[model samples]
Target: MTVKPADRDFDALFADPSTRARAARGVSIRLSGLTRRFGELEVLRGIDLDIAAGRFVAIVGRSGCGKSTLLRLLSGLDRPSGGELAFGAGEDDDVVPRLMFQEPRLLPWARVVDNVAVGLGRDRDAPDGRLRVASALAAVGLAEKAEAWPAVLSGGQKQRVALARALVSRPRFLALDEPLGALDALTRIGMQSLLERVWLAQGFTAVLVTHDVGEAIALADRVVMIEEGRVALDVAVDLPRPRRRGSAEAARLEAEILRHLVHEEPPDVGWVI
Candidate 1:
């Protein structure tokens, strides 16, 4: 597979056995007093959080709760008004992060491979670009559709291509903004499995923003609830991977998260700790 130009350092770390151990220790994210505002409105307010490297974190909230804004800042797509955002333990502290949105955002005129290649930016024309694109497509189970047009593929296929595009860059940080929200129920479940598999294989630090409490509990090592521009609750999900959706433990955790989103104020506040 061709190494993504931007991810050469990260990829190199994995290629060497000595560095591979270090690479598996995911990067740490530190945010202190993080704040963001638009005119008179504040979207994020004095937020502080720490994410262990290679861990999956899911942020959930109602609409307009500033979760998306926080994600934009984490992805470096938006600047924070105040606070420190730092990545720990890397030669280059700032790895180019990849962001996936609800829409596949594929170019209609570009073939599937080409669309995925776009993630490589100027590196798309590099000699190893084809190999890189092919590998990413195969990773997402879209190798058969690599040559097909985006318009010809189904919604799930397009999202798979989108995922391939997101992964093609070999990003150390993957920020997902409801990428699976548009899919059908069955497709959504399948994509969730695909996401978990890829995450486990790549060991990248993942931050997903979704309103689905169940989905958050199912995929995250920890679930953070954002309320009124602040972190209302941060809870660890101790459930094992490949969790049974209908399991009692899953249902209980889902209820715990839902309580925060549904209540104006936390119910029996002292009891929730």
Candidate 2:
């Protein structure tokens, strides 16, 4: 049988076999009538979604359209006021999920390696944790910055460190909330590439929330547009990877997503890049 990327054993890539075991082979999620409300405000209204294991999915919408709120529910950081959120077991379903935000959120007092070690918590003191930390830093190309303080690194480098931190735990599900929104245009593109590389290598289930539609199409296997606290568009990204920015196919996909955005009740503040 042919081995899919998610199914292949990555035992050779990781120094610690348990870390590789902890790595997510894939995770499938099911949401039925998921709802979240704050006082009279309904942030997510009956959201129903099925995310395939190991797929890269991007959620896009206006600033207050519940994209982040939906992600929060998926991260287990927030509970839905009503309805169900379920996960189907996979090879490493027991591994805890990790979240990454636009800000690196590193401590100025901590060295880069130390900040990554924070992801492992008590495991940082374990005999094999050091090796796993080194592996994650190398994956994000920040091995040399191991001893550098967060204040000394560039914005891009700091984000790389954050990526290393999120990865050191070998999470099964990675939820990114505008993780590249703060970087400069050039740096953002570079970071996007780095994120794609790491995701492909690790084969984790990724759900990214972003305002940039192009970035969504560039990395996601599927693009989901949320509007008015629900999913407005759920479509596959059929285009091949390393996709050209202005190619006819990419433009076509972007246009389809924009159509849904433009037709929303309130004007969309988010622009298609």
Candidate 3:
């Protein structure tokens, strides 16, 4: 039997007990002795970590640190090679996960509205589908661009469209794979604000993988630094909204993370025996 057009509430997916476990309070993403290998090279080593639910966290590392691979594992886009990957969602409800990539990946031949509706499943005629698609576009400030094709929109707009597609699903957990890496500096900053706005309205469990230290601190509630395929430092940001780069606090936190990330040392020059 075909499911009723009105039956699926994208929000309901998170309401499930299992889904709640994945994003609700007291839950964590635990990886024990996790490792991944491609041929003879190990990308991720014996990894063990936990991420609290409903917290915005950023993972950063130099190239080949397997940061993207970690996000993919959380999103279920890929499985772990040698560790248990369990989400706290529940036994009954599947983990409602979504991934946003660096590229917009919108269909050039499809209308902007239709591209978002693709996440709503195959049927475009349902009322819920229409409502979801319209609301998503509006959320990204592109309600008026619904009729436009991908080729007509600017780079930022296309990326916004891609974000809308991800939002339409009301995912319980969001895995971001450097979603703004491709945009120019100014545009990237704008997108950062736009992302925060969406997250504020619709609070979801988010794990962002980014190379930009400023961007990570500006957007994440917690920032985790990964090195040698393992998390090195996990710092929490207790600051106000609309965090601006070059702010006193931002500068301090950036310096702290960078000291570990680049110099491979902590602030110990002043330490005394």
How would the candidate models be sorted by lDDT, starting from the highest? Answer: 1, 2, 3
lDDT of 3 by residue, 43-92 (tens): 88877777666678899887778898888888887887898776664455
Poorest stretch of ten by lDDT in candidate 3: 1-10
Task: Candidate 3: give the clashing pairs.
Answer: 18-89, 18-90, 22-89
What is the clash count of model 3?
3
What would you estimate as the lDDT of candidate 1?
0.83
Per-residue lDDT of candidate 1, residues 140-239 (tens digit): 7777788899999999989989988998877788999989888888888888877886776677889999978889988999999988899999999998
List clashing residue pairs in candidate 1.
26-53
Estimate candidate 3's alpha-carbon lDDT, on a 0 to 1 scale: 0.77
Better of 1 and 3 by lDDT: 1
For every model shown, what is its TM-score relative to the native structure?
0.87, 0.87, 0.84
lDDT, model 1, position 233? 97
